[model samples]
Target chain A: MIENLKEIKKDELLSEVKKYADAKARFVTAVCNDLGDKLEVTYYFNASPGMEMSALRIAVGKDEEVPSLTGIYLTAVLIENEMKETFGLKVKDIAIDFGGHMFLAQDSPVLPMLKEKKEAAGEKGGE
Target chain B: MAPRTIAPFGPQHPVLPEPIQLKITYEDEKVVDVLPAIGYGHRGIEKACELNEYPKNIYLCERICGICSCIHGITYCEVVERLWPVEIPPRAKFLRTIWSEMSRTHSHLLWLGLLADAFGFESMFMQFWRIREKVLDLLEMTAGQRVTQSISVIGGVRRDLNGEQKKKCIEVLKEVRKESEALIGVLANDYTVKARTVGKGVLSKDQAIALGCAGPTLRASGVCEDCRMQKYQAYGDLEFEPIVETAGDSYARAVVRARETLQAIDLQLEALGKLPAGDINVSVKGNPPANEAIFRSEQPRGEVFYYAKGNGTRNLERLRVRTPTYANIPSLLVMLPGCELADVPIIALSIDPCISCTER
Candidate 1:
């Protein structure tokens, strides 16, 4: 029986994770590390109520840096890269060896989620 | 120590099926180091999911891997179906299982053909592909499409196998089995194949576990971790164990896949015999509530992990797919450095590298 964790604010989410980590693999469910705006926080099997899988929304405000979890978890490396690519979040101490070519087009006009619309009747007539 | 020459193996090469370039540092005939260069086929499939609706994304996800298209689609649907909690009908489950096994048969046969071609056994390659055509015809007949069939949906499957189609499938499968048995006999007992493949590109059991290799690659190394054992579909009702080999080499991998192909035929026959009678689908209404579900399924290559996040909408918030080839790449890197340059293709093929799946 898997329980779905609700969305928790950043501060409370961090505190909960720290509390679980202090217990060391006892309370914490499998933490699926995803690098994006939403942190998919999960509780292990038999996690108590109010302690289900919670997605913590990380704020990307200027001068308010996102905390690095690399010191704590090895799987955060790929997560950090995905965050930087998807959410435009700058992560510190996250080294990415791109191996020469840029894989993500961060500034493309056609966002995948947005519906494609024809160009407005015109800045310029058909040449 | 003399300076070693560095040469890139492929972004495109004849021997390599997928576009994976290995920057190999060679000391004459011996490889000192190999750095894998991937992302050649990356289409940002994860990003694409954001744009497409959940139902439409099924097609998008199916194309994630051409060989294991049905499995990919089924896995994606399973994740979404979990969010809604729709109980798929028994007939649908049986149909899904049948198509899945058919896909597996064709995929394994395709792999065998490529493996044969990799070793320069051109005639064997042709014979295997000729047998594989029957499986493809069956897929087209039942699913109405050959490759990347969008047969599965969130609630249940989109199509049902009628009695006539089922009989046709059984006939074709029997013919395929006969042809495949003959081909398997030749490959299993042939002098040249054994001479070329035996004791080549070995990966010890410990190394395989340590590197987190999955599916046939790990099974070939004697690790028995198969997701199908969990029995997501009618696999629970059916009976089978993970096929394994203790040798952990290219030869073992070949033998494992070859043997598994026969097992697939048997599984299909059993599934068809035990085909249930009922409605194909239970309608799933409304958007899925905010939920996260993790689904795992064994594709032709290995165990695939899919994580779906829904926020009570037609469009899913996030869908992440971690394919098996990505996990196997590290193990492949380990195998390449010790083997000769000529043996590289066979060793790489042994892992069944699907760069499209990995890079997507």
Candidate 2:
């Protein structure tokens, strides 16, 4: 488990990200996982001058829009576009908004991460 | 204001080995902005990992990128092993370290060859790959394949090195280190290579860390950071300093990698000498429990991060991978601007951007 995981409300994300960015923490990628009714978004950072991994997680409802971290951590632009495209998380005011098509072609499955697909147990059909 | 000419750099280009495009907006010869366009080669590997049982995910993870496949396999096994909190035999850790270093050795040479090729030094490119072939031979002799060895299992490595193979590996590596010095010398001393790379694509120390760059890209900027320092897997036993160069330019990046190629060779030789006598793997029982764990390891490019959550079932509830290239891409926004268009390809290649690893 993430030892330094700090659970924060969705509203506190930008400020929390601001605090890490203020400390000049290296902004690692953000992970968004499909929870039944909501998406769990986790931002990972390695504290500056050290390798301690710290994470801030916020739970978001499906339709809720999260503020972009690109304002503070410019690296967020790509991963945010990814979260938007795959999980369909609405991130408002991105610096370089790909408009949910960063890694997806038009007519591709929309929000592949948002779907509740079943694991193919004891079967490897996609080879 | 000069009228901007926006050119799409690539979904397919001469410099980039894989499919990733950068929308380069140039004001005459100098670049003003670079917006990236990717996703041409996305295979939904993470989505596939979630579909398979925890044990089956190893194969899928190993294929994430052909060049860095061994490290991918090691990282996957390490992350899942952390879930079970499995204790691998000491011999296995050394074996993994040896193989991991072998991967780093070949990968750096391949990048060096590509970097030479990017600068239009065709003969140097051929020379670098010729040395890389030796490393590939060593990997194939030990693991049964050249690129994606698939030697790593959940608890430990699937194969072990007998005595004859160990002696042969040491002899071949020492010769590799000796031969590499001549080619690497050219990178350090060549005027044309230096003119093209020395002051180009400069990412400052602060920008490198703040932008989340990794591997040689991060180290070359003088951050004193490497995932190996965290000592996951067998790296704890392997004592070495992370290579650092302060210029933060493409040449500095090249020097860092050029030196690291030698370092990787030294590391493999050390691990081979320290090979312990014991069983290679421990039997892992039961499925992964309800656990969420994060693992970070140094690949040839930089550090790779993996997050896995098990639902107490055979399959993982969620699997996330954040590759080094993905983290380093945004730094291109910083590097490309203010560089002459002629220098773009070398600057892009300096990051050693593995788009297959990035897009996956």
Candidate 3:
């Protein structure tokens, strides 16, 4: 439900994100507010252009990652792992037991995303 | 203590439509561990979007999913429009809404037919698909293309719904409504369907929400998380509620989708009746600003997320699409364990795994 997206300065956003000490609550509040929800403003982070920017995603309601609710947001681990794989951003402590090599195959299709970006830049003569 | 036997389910199976191999470690019939090996159909569509212009990318996006092509194209157009911020005409919005619901009806019917086939109910499958033919005929009549309509554009839709076409759509919807009601009666009251689907592959409300499940899958699990509730296009003006079922099992999912098909038919009729007379396409001016926007739309299977990054150019810098089947895959994996081998097809079909959409 990302109704509105506001791009803020990286440093200021990181400082805002630090305000919410609890990682789970902080993540939820940041996502909710980013999607134009009237939730209590907690924390914000300025993600890097290609890396952090791609990892930036918001999931509302029960999908938010909190240890209290374990199995409900199971796909959040995959989403977070996908972010880590594609953009090199870490999601702190997530993932129950890595599905191992089987899950590794999911990352295979994603390599092209990062590779193509570099290849396109090279084609443009290091633009 | 016994060593676990590892067995590969399939990269290709006679039953499964998509090529997904599951490396299942089994202690006899019980699956101790499952390793899903995907990436057989990855086509780099998102990367290709960077090479194509915004308008042409709509066609490319439509190709992402044959069943939900209109939604994909609409989503791509909306993402580009978000960067530009142009107002779509009410007439166009209404027409788009109608088309969207029509697509939904056909998709649900198609899935229902497949589910019936999975359950080994060939007669039911044939009947459901025979009913679905009416929907396909309606689509062909209106869009002039059955699968990839390419009817949607950036500012608005490509074609206008004329008076005669509107009448035809209404008539077709009326026929579909009658046929679908009969089909629904068979699905609901029929003993064979209930015996096969009920109490199978149950994902509770908490599990559904936690897994980021969307569309009928989440709805069946009692989570009222329909993207249409956000009122995109003419959905804001329309009156409908998200179909919900408390069971959270395969039966519930089937019921949710079946009910949704009926609701879609009703919505299409309402849209056609309230078809406004106005311009179809709005002229977009200048290059899109360097900004990013996330566009979420309710596809036939579930929610489709499209992230578009514009850099004041005809070509989009980045485009990321997250299909519902990808989200639902985790739930499928969890449900697969502890189920009998005979029930595998039904459980898989319950989520309506559209691998092409997911792999794209």
Candidate 4:
């Protein structure tokens, strides 16, 4: 269970992740939740001396560019690439870019996991 | 100075059983850098979770990794149970603990064999898998499956362990313990094993924590962090302590997993002795409320994370898993840069990467 989620703006997300990184916190993973209008990104970090978990949440419009945290926490590289491929969100300065071939096949549907409800229905009707 | 050459380590190689391609940039015999290209085994399982009903998703989650199958289902159930808020019986909790450890034992033994094979220790590789078969037999006897034991559901376990089955399990574990002790002795002191592993692919404590290395990999670096210590199931009542090794090298990682195999067996025996009586499962009749839940557990490789978001429907809105191997992959990137080219296979196998688990 995650608690004390402070919603930071997109600009502050990297510094916030770095603050925890300096506290010897292990970067758990980052997740993107599609909230219809705006997407919410939550990065989970676990700190010890006690296995206490704290998360930072940031809401960005679907087209907003979120800065990649791979510079601060090197492990952020994989999850960031995944977020780019699966959700089709624009990420700025990822440490490694697979040029949209990280997980999806080139022949596969574009942004298959990011379809909005009505758009999904329209696509389904078209097919 | 030796000229640099680009060598592709795999998408298929004799040493690797998976489809991850490591494009290695090498200067003569020393590796200068490695760029790993994955996703060859991706099955789009997470997207599939949004299509299936909640209960049936249990079986789908179990297939995420054949090595650590039970934990995937258990973690999924823990997330769903949080949303549905089902209070499972005590008997079911104990059963979950037992089966999870059974999978841990089998997974670790399988890794030990594979690590041996990676370094060209063929006879030792056969010996380790020989012990692994007995552990698999115990899992099959109880859960009726060899690899994917679909005992976990949304509410609780799908089956119960009887008295006779319990006794047989203990006996089989005793034989496993004896066989493993002999193999562990060889792993610990054998000159060839030590020569290949002792100083190779070292991940310091600071680096392991910074890179978020999980499970035995983190523990081997003297981190003292284990998801099991969080005591999610009946582990609170069970006596437990995480095994830690200070060296943080390939041998330390192997030693930590070897010791953990014995640790998992002890915990299983203790849970079996203290087994309680009650229903193995409970019935749930509705969709989860609109909310999100996260569950973490100690899988054999490291910490496994499950995140589920419910939208008041039979199918979940989103299901995300951050497997141990995924967390450990960056550490591989850190370790590979300075090692000799010939040592790459041994170094790669040390983390016990399950690309299927990572790419799923």
Clashing residue pairs in all predictions, respectively, total: 3, 1, 7, 2
Instruction: State the TM-score for model 3.
Output: 0.82
The digit string of per-residue lDDT tens for model 4 on B245-295 reads 989989999999999999899999999999998898899889999888888
lDDT tens string, model 3, B1-360? 567788887777655688877677776666666666665776768779978888889889999989889989999888888897878999889878888898999899988888878767788889888888888887788788888888888789988777787787788788888988887888787887888888888898766655556678877888776778768899888887788898999999999999999999999888777777889989987779887777678888887878777789888877878788887877876777777666666877889888888778
In model 2, which residue pairs have backbone atoms overlapping below 3 Å?
A: B215-B302
User: Isolated chain A: TM-score per model?
Assistant: 0.42, 0.88, 0.30, 0.85
Could you give the CAPRI-style class of model 1?
incorrect
Q: What are the models' TM-scores?
A: 0.82, 0.97, 0.82, 0.96
The most accurate candidate by lDDT is 2
When candidate 1 is compared with the true two-chain complex, its DockQ is 0.11
The DockQ score of candidate 4 comes to 0.63
Residues A31-96, candidate 1: write the lDDT tens digits: 333334333434231122111233333334422445544444322344444444433344566533
| lDDT score for residue B340 of model 4 | 92
B82 Cα displacement, candidate 1 (Å) = 0.4
Model 2 lDDT tens row, A49-94: 6678999999999889999999888888989999988887889999
lDDT scores in order: 0.72, 0.89, 0.69, 0.87
DockQ, per-model, please?
Answer: 0.11, 0.66, 0.17, 0.63
Q: Which candidate is the best by DockQ?
A: 2
CAPRI quality of model 4 = medium
Which TM-score value belongs to model 1? 0.82
